[model samples]
Target chain A: MADVLLSAKDIKIRFGGVIAADGINLEVHEGENLAIIGPNGAGKTTFLNISTGYLRPQAGTVTFLGQDITAHLPRTITKLGIARAFQIPQLFLDQTVMENMLIAAASRQGYPSGFKALSRLPEASEMERLLELVGVRSYAERKARELPEGQRKLVDIALALALKPRLLLMDEPTSGVASSEKLEIMDILTAALAKEKVTSVFVEHDMDMVERYAHRVAVWNVGKIQKVGTPAEVLADPKVQQQVIGI
Target chain B: MTRRIKPITTAAVIFFLVSAVAPLFVSSWATLFALILAKGIVVLGIVLLLQAGQVSFGHAMFFAIGAYTSAFWGKYIGGGDILLYLVLGGISSTVFGLIVGLFVVRYREIFFGMLNLAFSMVLWSLLEKMFPYTNGADGIRVARPGLLGFVFTPETFQYVILYVSLLIAAAAFYGVQRYLESPLGHMLRAIKSNETRLEYLGMSARRVLLIGYVISAFLGGIGGTLVAIIQQIATPEFGFWTKSGEFVFIAILGGGAHAFGAFAGAAMFEWVRFYAAAHLADSWQLILGVVLIVIILYAPNGLIGLRQRYRQSGKRGR
Candidate 1:
């Protein structure tokens, strides 16, 4: 079996009366593109938040790289090589694309010391390469707020990649993007992720994106995993088709 | 890169030239200019916190602490050395900032502003009510401090103080400008942009904020110490909420675009007030209000933004 890069067992969380994550167990193996497909409020994002230390589950534990990290701070988890990209591009709107990339690269190298200028960061070449890989190199000088939705998504992914994480979690990378540009965004994203040799577990609602890129799919229904298997197997399942795909 | 470095170099040259030659030409304005420089230093501290997206309405408390610490050293410890007083002033206010920051850094926006104001008010009340130690509302008097063991006479005191204030302002501007270009400075801007994203990038936003707060307090202290020496008085009003408000006013007027913006704002404010008080007297504040309104509406980024817009329009015209 492939070594599990991230594992969560018996995870449970409640928001007032709503159970956001309930008795859920998941394992993401190294270097695999795993897609989580769920209806709205199905706890897919809640689970991702728990795994990334954004939300702490009321019960259950998350282990990453064989270390228990259920109570670690989000930054601590990030330093341990797990990075996340938000559904809404969480970028520095006032900063340029290259500046945003440099900030991430600086954090990963270790917080900048006193009087050490950004010019000395040593990540300029690598930042250029990452921006080029994600196809946003042309927009390097443009402020993040000025970028179109499709390009913003690409910049967000590039920012995540700059962290040099062993595992990357993406939440709805294509949701805000126009339908026509979804495939192109995913193409640049997946290609860059592969080239960086990063393991990814993404929550995606677009079935087409899942079918194209996900090596395996986990169907989440009402805070529980209904089934986990090859995309062909899960997509062909009658229950998944009837409920999730709304066949 | 050359384009960016050129402006900074030009600004540096102008700053040094003015500092070196201005004393000879306008020694009469030295006292007023020194006061502006001291306040500008405090506003520089505010600029740092503003970069982190945190505003403090109680920084005057640190200013008062710096002033009073220096006063205490002069009165009780018999420390006649101005350099030692400056260090003591900075250290005392930094220690206070470190302690208060532990609680203040956890709050954001209005809560942060209110907490700082509350602390400042408390300090103000203490200074007003403490009779023996602080000399109550009448305040404590500070004598002309000897610099490097050279006792300054009344005639030469203004020049010496002007030189010291200029030296401090230059150092503060250079240090802050360099810092804003640094990696940590980028992180500070990121904290304002999207703190959660910054944490996900692997930095503790709270820790970063606390460090910034402490540094700002240290600067405020140094500024306060200078002001106290200039005025030769540390009053209860030094820690008043309105005093803190003035720092915020200068910071916004200067715009937070660059470190030197603080000085620009301070100079404009001092000159405007000087002339307004001389001519308009009763209507000076009204004129100041009108000027601020105009700046807010036309140049919301402050004077720096106004300059940038002019340059851009000039380029377009060409």
Candidate 2:
């Protein structure tokens, strides 16, 4: 039994006519890769938002490491060792891939004031390794604006990895990726996460990806967790497939 | 143009040396050069603001604050020390900057710029209405400030001002260049690129911007102090909206690539305006307008961004 790293208890939130979260209870544990899968508007992203402090749930408490982080700002949550990657690549377009990774690494450690050169900082090599892990090392000097969508996605993931977080949350990490290329990207990302030994929670649509990469799968539907089990058991459940996977 | 034939520091050293001797060649316009260099310092600060995708059209208020600080020191404190005026000018404007930045840094883009314009206009009206203390639109006379205990005759004062302006300009250029290269400076640029990403990375974009804003206002003060010293007066016109526009104009003219670009842009801008006003006083503004349009059309990067489109530059800022 692994220790629970993040606990969301009796979480509830609503937006006008839509119920985003209704008493959603989920516990992400240490040393496990968790995949959250659901159809659109299933409150998976809203929950991720709540965890990252982008959206304050009308009701709910998010606890990380036994400390209440529900009201923390995104930056504060990041400092507490939570990092997130967006589905759409959010990057400093003018800076190079290497610079982006360096910034992410520097940001985690806390930025230095007073004329300290960024290039001379120790994060350079570490950032380069993260870039390599995500297979964007070859494009290190390429400006982020120049990278194609596929490469941008990898770089964005690399940036998240650079944060060196205790828990890493990603929103539809492979959504923009081509179906053919999704598995391969997931392989590299999961390998990097395994190497880093970071707890991972990802919202994914591809059941194949979930079955392959996720240690455990949590099926979400209409703002509620429909099922939670090992990938085989959850995917085998007829109700989850009908509701979430539409099979 | 080749981007890096010589390192920026080396080029700066050479440029400063040449500028130091420039007053001898153009002795007739020593005061003009001093004024231009001072404006360059102000534009240098604007360059930093531009990096954060923020623009202040009201920086001339800081300039006016610098000039007034010097004027008050001379009138009330009874001293003409240039060092004291410059230090006080920087400190006073920085104080104002911190106070204003606390409010303005919360906004971005047009709101940030408009708020600054609004604040400067308020200061301008205050300077105009406070006739007893401010001397109204006529302005107060700024007595010639002594430099490190030496009172130069008018004939020598121009040269002293030029040399001092040149020294301060060099230091400012170097300091700004260094600051822009630092991590904090990088984050300032990052704020422009994607503020959301910066926040998720665990830094407040507003805090970074405030730091840059205060520094920019301090530079504006420095420039204002120098201009007052050269002209021997501090007028409410110093805080006028048009004067703030000049700071923005020169910043755009120089491009935001590097600090030294501000100096080049300022020199070219002042000279063009001078000649235009001399030759065609009625439509000098028309000539300036044409030049800006041309610059915007062709060299969008300003004078410093002027280079053979290198591979290093991709799809840059929109």
Candidate 3:
């Protein structure tokens, strides 16, 4: 197996008597796409929250590249080489797609200060290249609010990728996208992640995407990882088939 | 239609020169223009705050801080150099801004405005109730400050303040326009758009807000100092809640997020009020209130947006 890039040990969280994550331990190996599949309220995103520093787990230690980042801030985690793409596509909607990329670029350059020309960043070409990688180069001049849903998801990912994260966490990359466009978004996402050689952990509901993109599958059920295996091993299980995929 | 910086700047320069020389021709309007220019600086600060979707309803506290800093300096140190007063006054307000901003920038929308209002009210009460030191409601009388080392008489002082206020207003307007095009400016817009994404990008929104707040405070302070110099006194009314309202009123009247709008709004606000008070003293407030309502309803984006709409439609017509 590849060396672990991020390890979460004994994670626990509860929100007003409802346990979101409890005694959950998972390891994401370097340079592999890990899919987390769960039903509603299973805390797949909660795990992402704890990992990304949005939520500090009540009990757990999350270490990334040998650093204990369990309760670190989201921005700190991002600066420490872990970046997240929101399921709802959090973006600077009024700004152009290229401007969004430039913001991401500016953030990486120490949260940006001074009167440096935004349109003429030194890494402007690099921003263009990243947009091209995510297939959003054509919409670079377009406002983020004007992009279609699928393109919004792609740009969100592209913005995350601009941080040059060693490990990328995505909370349902295709949640709002049309079903007809799901596979296309997944294709672009997978291709981009593969090219970037990033270790990714994504919570997904689409079995087709999970089967196609994920190297390993972790089934989350009520604050615990019930099973973890290769996609074939996990998806083939009778319980997983019944409880998760509902096949 | 396009914002060609050089032409606008040249025009602004000419406008300022005209205003500076206006006292030579139309001396009665000079003081009025001087007051407009000073308040214009304050509105520009509000414009910067507006760019980040923030409106400091209590910003007059900084204005008062600047005003008071100069008053206190004149009272204690007897420093008359205009540059010294401006520097000290701006620094004093900026320091207070940094302190207040550290707390207020953590909030958003109404909370931010209320918190700023609360702080300014505190300053206002201190100035009003503290009779021993602050001189209560009568305010502190300040001697006329000088430019360089020359003691300015009333004759030279009016021209001194008029030209100085015009110069600073032009610089601030141009600087703010330039700043709005910079990366940090874009970051301010990003904060307004989605702070969550800003953080995930490894930047804190609170930190960005604090910086903007500090800059706004600095501008407000400078404006206060200029106005105080022109008035030759610092009063509790400087930090009053309604005074802050007037700043917001001017900001909206001028424009939202457009630097030029702030100046235009200040000019219109002062000139209209000055003339209307003389002619229609009983109903001037009513007329201005009606004007604000109309602007909010029809031109909600403010003057700049109105101008842009006309220009774009004119092009379409062509």
Each model's total of backbone clashes: 0, 0, 1
Q: What's the lDDT for residue A58 in model 2?
A: 83
Q: Candidate 2: what lDDT?
A: 0.88
Interface RMSDs of the predictions, in order, are 1.1, 1.1, 1.1
lDDT of each: 0.89, 0.88, 0.88
lDDT of 1 by residue, B237-279 (tens): 9999989998898888878878877887888788788889999
- Residue B83 shift from truth in candidate 3, angstroms: 0.7
Residue ranges of candidate 3 with Cα displaced over 4 Å: B1-18, B312-318
* Candidate 1 pairs with clashing backbones: none
Which regions of candidate 2 fall more than 4 Å away from where they truly are?
A: B1-14, B309-318
Alpha-carbon error at B155 in model 2, in Å?
1.5
Candidates sorted on DockQ, descending: 1, 3, 2
Evaluated at residue A37, the lDDT of candidate 2 is 95
At residue B169, candidate 1 shows an lDDT of: 87
A42-160: candidate 2 lDDT, tens digit per residue: 99999999999999988889999999999999999999989998889899999888878877877877767768677777889888888888888999988899998888988988888
Q: What is the model-wide C-alpha lDDT for candidate 3? A: 0.88
